[model samples]
Target: MKVALFGLGYVGCVSAGCFARAGHDVYGVDVNPVKVEILRSGKSPIVEKDVGELIAAAVEAGRLHATTSASEAVHATQVSLICVGTPSHPNGSLDLRYIYRVAEEIGAALRHRDAYHVVVIRSTVMPGTAAEVARILETQTGRKQGEGFGVVVNPEFLREGSAVSDFVEPPFTLLGGEHERALDVVAQLYADVDAPIVRAETRVAEMVKYANNVYHAAKITFANEVGNVCKALGIDSHKVMEIFCMDEKLNVSAAYLKPGFAFGGSCLPKDLRALTFRAKDLDIPVPMLESLIASNALQIRRVVDQLLRWKARKLGFLGLSFKGGTDDLRESPIVEVVETMIGKGYDVRIYDANVSLARLFGANKEYIEKEIPHIERLMCKTMDEVLEHADVIVIGNRSSEFAAALGRLRPEQRALDLVRLLDEPPESERYEGICW
Candidate 1:
C-alpha cells in the first residue's frame, strides 16, 4: 500500500517511518521545504528515539520519499494520513487552519483523480472536525463522500520520544467514520499492527484523544497533590502509593474510572471527606482532591436540574445497582439523587438488572426503605416496563443494554445522561448530559 503522510513533524515523521518500515510505501508531505529536503536526504527532521534510523533505512530501501506538494503526495498513495499539528490559538481554541488547509488541498487533489481514495485524519482534533473535513472535501470535489471518496478519522496516540514503539504497539487503535468500506480499507492498512481496533463514529474518534490526554493530566495532578499532602504531614508518599497501587480492588486503579452515577460508595465518599478534613486541619490545601466531591455533587445537581427543567412529571431510571453488575447499593450516590427527586414530588420508576426486592431483605433493604421507600413502589419488573412508564429517562449506569436503548428514545421524550451513551446523540426532541 502506498501511503501519503501529511506534516513531517514529530508525529508525522515517526508515522511515515514506521509505516514504511511495515512494508508500506510512504511519502512524507509538508509545507516546509527544509523538512522535505532533510527527509529527501534520508535524514529525519525531528529528534526522536529510533525514528531517524528507521527513516534512513526506509529511504535507502526505496520504500519512502518526501514531497512538498500535497496533490503529488495524494496522487502517489492510495491512502492519505493527515498528521499535521493542531496547536492552540490565543484564546485556547484549536487552530484548525492547518486542518482546513490540508483538507482543501486533499479535496482539490481528489477533483482531478478518478480512482477512489481514502483520507484518514491522524491529527488531534475536536469532535466535529472529521465531519467538517469531509464536508470540505465534498464541496471542493463536487462529489459525495463515502461514494466518490472515503473519509475517516484515525487519531494517533504516540507520545513524544517513544513514537516509533508506540506506533508499533499502541494501547489501542480507533477508526471513525460512516463508510464501512472506508473503515475496512483503513483497518486493513493496520492489519499487521498489534492493537485493539475500536470502530466508532467520527465525533467519538475525534474526542478519544482529548479524553485520554485530559485524564492522564488529571491523574498526574491528583498524584502530585496527594504527594504534596503526604509530604506536609511527614508521611512517605511513595510507600503509600506503592501500597495503594497493590490494591487492584480500588485505589490507583481503574475502579472509579467508569462513567456512572456520581461516586458515593461507603469508602470513597467517607474517605474523601476524611482526607479533605485532614488537609484542612493541617492548613495544607488540596484543591484537586477537594474539588472531587464538589465536582461530583455538581454532576448530581446537573441531573436534578435537567429533570426539573424538562418538567418531567415521572422519571424512569433503568439501573439502580450503583453499577449494573454489582449488588451493593450501600452508598450509591444515585439513591440520594432519586430520593431527593422523589422528595421534590416527582414520581420515579427504577429497575436494575441485578437488584431484586427479595434480595434486599436485610440492611440494604432497610436502608432503601427508610431513605428512599418510594424506590420499592417504583421498582419495575423489567427495563422495557420502566421505559414505557416515564416521561423522561435517566441512564445512571454503564449497562450495555442501556447504551443500546439510547436509540429507542421517543421523539418527545428527554434523556439526561450521566454516562455518555452515544458518541453523538441524534438531534431529537430532548437529550442532555452532566458533561459532554
Candidate 2:
C-alpha cells in the first residue's frame, strides 16, 4: 500500500518510518522545507528512541520519501493519512486551522484522482470532525463521500518516548469509517501490527484519545494527592498505593467510572470527608480532593435545575436511598435533591422499596428526620402510587424495578434520570439525562 502522511512532527515521522518498515511505501508531506529535506535525505526530523534509525533504514531501502507536493503524493498513494497538529486555541479550544488546511489540500489533490481514495485522519480531534473532513472533501472534489472518496478516523495511541515500540505493539487498533471499502483499506494497513482491530462508531473513535489522555492525567493527580496526604502523615505513599493497586476488583480498575449522578453511600462520603478534613487540619490543601464534595453537590444542583426548567408541578422519585439494595440514607445526594424540591414548593412523592418510615432506625432514621422533618408523609406505599401522583418521574437510583418504568411512561409524562437505570436512555423526547 502506498501512503501519504501529512505533517512531519513526532507522530508523522514515527508513523512514516514504521509503516515503511512494515513493507508499505510511505511518502511524508509537510510545509516545512527543512523537515521535508531531512526526510528526503534518509534522516528523521524529530528525536525519539528509535525513530531516527528506523527512518534511515526505510529511506535507504527505497520504501520511503518526502516531498512538499500534495498532488504528487496523492497520485502515488491510494490512501492519505492526515497527521497535522491540532494545537489549543487562546480560549483552550482546539485550533483546527492546520487540520482544515491539510483537508483543503487533500480535497484539492483528490480532484484529479479517478480511483476511490481513503482519507484517514490520524490526528486527535473532537467528535464530528470526521464528518467535517468528509464534507470538505466532497465540496472541493465535487464528489460524494462513500462513492468517489471516504474518510476514516484512526486515532494514534503512541506515547512520545516509546512511539516506535507502541506503534509496533499497540494496545488495540481502532478504525471508524462510514464506507466498508475505506474501512477495509485502513484495516489492511495495520494487518502486520499485532493488536486487536476494533470497529467503532466514527464519533466514539474520535473521542477515544481524549478519554485516554484525561484518564491518564487524572490518575497522575490522584496519585500525587495521595502521596501528599501520606507525606503529611509520615507514611510511605508508594507502599500504600502498591497495596491499593492490588485490588483489581475496585481500585485501579473500572469500578466507579460512569456518567451519572453524584456518588453517595455510608462509607464513601464519610471516608472522603474524613480524609479531606484531615488534610485541612494538617495545613495541606489538596484541591483535587477538596473539590470532590463540591463537585458532588453541583451534580445535585444540576438535577434540581433540570427539574425546575421543566416547570413540572408534581415530581416523583423512584428510589430514595443513596444506592440500590441498601436502606442507608446517611449523606445520600438524592435525599438532598428531594429536600430542595420540596422546599421550593414542588409537590414531591418518593418510593423506595428498601426504605420504610416505620422501620427507620439509628443514624439513618435520625439523619432523614433532620433533613426532612416530615419524612413519613413524603414516602409512598408503591411505585404506582408515586407515578400516578406526579407528572414528572425522577429516576434517582439504579434499581431493577425502575428499569422498565421509562418504557411504560405515557406520551405526556416526562422522566429525569439522575441514574441511568436503563441500559440506554429511552427514545422518547420526554426522557432527559442528568449528564450524558
> lDDT (0-100) at residue 420 of candidate 1?
75
State the lDDT of candidate 1 residue by residue for 359-417, as single tens digits.
Answer: 55544666666665667778888888878888898988767888866778776777877
Query: For all candidates, what are the clash counts?
Result: 0, 0
lDDT of 1: 0.85
Q: Which stretches of candidate 2 lie over 4 Å from their true place?
A: 357-373
Q: Model 1 Cα displacement at 332 (Å)?
A: 4.8
State the lDDT of candidate 2 residue by residue for 246-268, as single tens digits: 99999977888888899987888
| Highest TM-score against the true fold, candidate | 2
Error of 1 at 84 (Å): 0.7
Give the whole-model CA lDDT for all candidates, comma-separated: 0.85, 0.89
